[model samples]
Target: MPYLLPPPRAAQPQRLLAPTVTHLARLLLTHAPAIPPLLTAILPSSPSLLTPLLSHLLLSHSPPLPALSLFRRLLELPHFPVPESALPVLLRLLARSRRYAHHSFQLLESLPSTHPHLLSVPALSVIISTALCASAPGASFAAAVSCFESAAAVWARAGRSFGAAELNALLRVFCARGRVAEARALFHRYCDAYPPDTRTFNTLLLGFKEAGHAQALDLFYHDAVLRGFVPDAVSYCVRMDAYCKKGKFLDALQLLDEMRKRENCKPTLQVFTTLIYGAGIVRDAARARRLFDEMEQSGVTPDRGAHNALMGAYVRARDLQSGMALMSEMEQKSFGLDDVTYNTMLCEFQRAGDLEGIWKIYTKMTGSGFMPRTRTTMLLMKVFCENGRPDLGLELWDYLIGKGCVPHRHALDVLVTGLCCRDVVGEAYRCFRELVEMGMAPTERAFRVLEGFLKKKREFGKIDEIRQMMKAIQLEEHQAEEEAA
Candidate 1:
């Protein structure tokens, strides 16, 4: 089989100069039939750079189904070079984009019949690993277990057994769902085929730390060391994080000491920052300050993240002045404050009923080219609603909607809940109706708030209307749920 030579460079000399993904996407969209040949010709030149081009197309330009269609076309071609390097990137993009993650797995099932060259232990391992992060059926523990079952079915049908890494990813998923015992059971079941590695144990430790099972951390470490897995920086970080989380500050400090004594296992910036946050969490600002100084003394420069950790500690301690001073220092060092900084300040000022303070930070956030995030908008709107400034909340809503930006469902929920609480039930009703029309469900909290208002007013007719609407919505939700399954 002859290779697919490059398309006539003479015909498109300008393409050689730019070769931008956006430009290629335009070409593919306009000349859909040419995608396979274009890919066949171009991919061989630089698979590494061009692999990301396909991802850019999927994530930035095209939807999943159509983008996969193009990929399928390339795979089906007569002389196309196999897109081995690119497939991982494509699969990862699919897994992370919540609307399209399941399609990523579906790609795995399609591989045997269509693109077996793309099917391998390594590729499927990556797909399985990425799929672990994708949501399960219902986001419950049972859903998580079921997700593993479905993944196993996909594995069996693909005619391949999982490698250590894939199995570890599956184990991580189970542990993350607060089903640590299930993860442990699954690991033991497959230990002979794929024994736990350092990365595997690291994930297990992180999962326990996240799930708030500090006690499990020690058990896991003992098991790992007994099994001869060399403890690495990741191993210590997990335990240190667990220690910090559990308010074992001195213990966390002791672990830092132990880490220092180990050859090639010095405490990282992450370790120091973790301790600082832990100190902040338990209101040990003095210890946190000492850790910062210690970090600098150890030749680890305090980064923006370190400053943010201290700011968070100050916020927790209700010391806004100190937090502001910390912010000023970060700025003087040209360390840009992130959404975390602004959101923390916004929350602190909100608690103090300092409306002007809230506005001041918000203005700075917006002026500094920071787009409003979901949490930032929700809390800001909630403050307005709570402090008898629903008008300002509505203004912000209009501003968002005018720019064709959809606020988070929770933001809309806050608005409706606030309107009903403030006795603006008619506006709340309008907002609720618009949300439903937009094909997004209002939260049960929003519905209850509105229903409470209508009941207090004895609006019997409106109550009947709400009842009917509720039934219809429930039916639609059930049907949609079935369709998704």
Candidate 2:
């Protein structure tokens, strides 16, 4: 027939992959009914034009509306080279929705030709900050490296001409995640182009501590100031924290003194509290008290943090009398006791087999409506288990789950471990199942504990069940890792 005959060569048009503009417009109307009229006016409803009309409109539209992200996807669907002009708007949209940001980044990199203009500075800043901050939950320190690598690829491809703000944003992400070596290398390489600011230096100082290289922090700080980046109060506080983390309390105190002597560099509460924490670790309650007094003298009233630190010090020194006295003083100041206060007291009492003290503290904590954190709950679990009160420990576990408090894997492991040791297989298996349902795979220790009990009982069927459950967890985790990567 005439239709069966091949279409005339002159009338033949190329096959199109991208949905037609009419189809895309219908989608916009269906999915995004509240799309701006301005956008509607711009997007022509032409069927022949296969590329989405919204892709072109993205360049001109600057609204923060959610509809813009759909255009980013439409533009990338047919592997179209996105206009350099639209990068900023797309990035701002991407910042609000990380899923789109990730897809756009992936698509942009996949396109054969690289456009330097497409990697705008503001976009890169938002990309670096959001990517790192939205990093996978429970990601270890190594994940920080992968996150920086991803951002760095974007920077490198964009001709690496990012502005100071973008570089600072990337540096902050690096420092936040303990990638000190990477942050320092990046700083040294790019600092000359966009000279590091005081905030940049402060972030790097914190990074050294987080990276367990506090020994290098002092030298880095001295070199930074000598390079004409004057230290601010926050800078001093960061350095003080580094020294405190390194167990150099005297050095921290000396740094505090130096900061105080400097014009307009008064140590903040965090600075004093960091030193107090150091003093607590060294059992130097006297020094913690001195720092506390100095904090008040500096016109920064001691907050609950300051009280917490000193009280922690007393507990460390086994001077419960002094710690209790401080608690009384804290009450007078209307500074309510926190979980750490109760946890520290409970742990010590647990060690001493003081059941009465533990009971009193538990009663008070529950009575005051203080929602205990995972640590508080874990400490309580351990205490109850060690004191031959497995029933209470199991009840507490159930109570936390009933309260919608998803325990950490390690915390669940603690319960499993305790129960398994007591040959309480049924209860331990219940906790294991609960953790599985909560999407948390138990620790190897937890598994080993359960396996030991199951094997001793020669219950190969349950053993097989444990293996199957573990396989499911491993498969799910592997899928998640693939998705994250």
Candidate 3:
């Protein structure tokens, strides 16, 4: 009987102790002036514990009082190095409050000098994005641009290289808002400071592609390759999609082959998906089918997006049988359909005015445990109204609301307008009032439709009440815009 060696004990990885928010909150609230020494004493080995500790306080749904109090206390400790991870969340929280918004900007402007480590790309992006979303039209752009320059200046002083990521973030913001020209100008202005990298060119390429600047996109791609920045899959995708948008499907396919032959650049799923979507837009079902098959042969297993894009092509080309067959195949693969899948089918049904098909898709969608989103709600309401079934539309609205779909003002507007069109004014008024009670105001067009119906029906009382409500809503919105700015 040979003695068996005991199995070697498995090594246990060290686990981080969870920060107790309650204890920290009590300390901050009770010993406001002594946070620094107390934190140092408690977290002697890990000052970074304050990171997750502050994150919990800031991100909680509880009233902002505790978080604000903690933040003020932490800010008072000039030597405390606020974690990079916490700054973005803290800025977002402060940006949401009218009084604290200025403090957030002040902190952003001062962070690189005051705490350079906390001036992360994500933190700057959050501040820039928040400023860009401000309600006052051009003022928002001005603020965003100002913040961008200020960050650049502060970062330069902190001996930090404001690199490609920070530049790309700002570029994305401008491009996303359809400010491609401005984004290009920004690229030019910063190229000297942050030498243009592959991602820099890719960002501009996508910006130009989205803005429909075909000539600029072409020129930029050539310039990038000439400048020794080898175009990656993304670069190829942007150029391919640009060609597709210009109705040059053959050229796009040729480029796809070109990328496949390259050393490191291989055709990605996006590459295939882009071609399929382009084919869909042109109603070229044959091309889409070929691309889908080629994608699988190339070892890029099709995801939901690829399947949906193929389906879109089939339906657009009036090949309903092929579309249904493809959908069945997707189900057979066991990945199951998602919101986009259902929505794609619904869009086709709606476009064809096939109310029966729409209902079938809706049934399947719900049977799969899918909840209706705003888009789904809008489509159903529109189709129902078009089919002279405002009653069903109203019922659908109630059902969706019951299922916790927050009332979408646009969808409500569609239902109300439909009701008014079909002379179901009383029901429309009731729905409008319900929306008001739910703290949403429908579109002005819906209001006008309701008002017109009331006037014809000699319901001056309801009209007067609605007018007053509209005035109050408008005033509230104006004040909110001011605060947001």
Query: Please, what is the TM-score per model?
Result: 0.67, 0.61, 0.70
Better of 1 and 3 by TM-score: 3
Report clash pairs, candidate 3. Answer: none
| lDDT tens digits by residue: candidate 2, 337-391 | 9877888888877777677677777767766745567678878887777666665
Number of the predicted model whose lDDT against the real structure is largest: 3
Backbone clashes for every candidate come to: 0, 0, 0
Q: Rate the local accuracy (lDDT) of all candidates.
A: 0.69, 0.66, 0.74
* Model 3, residue 137: C-alpha shift (Å): 7.7
Candidate 2: misplaced stretches above 4 Å? 1-166, 172-179, 192-195, 208-216, 245-248, 328-337, 350-355, 369-371, 417-426, 443-475, 478-485
Off by over 4 Å in 1: 1-104, 111-162, 331-335, 402-404, 417-438, 443-479
Which window of ten consecutive residues has the lowest lDDT sum in model 1?
3-12
RMSD of each: 12.3, 18.3, 13.6
Tell how far residue 95 is off in model 1, in angstroms.
Answer: 9.1
TM-score, candidate 3, is 0.70
What's the lDDT for residue 147 in model 2?
50
**Candidate 3 residue-wise lDDT, 320-362, digit = tens:** 6687688789989987887677778888877776666777776
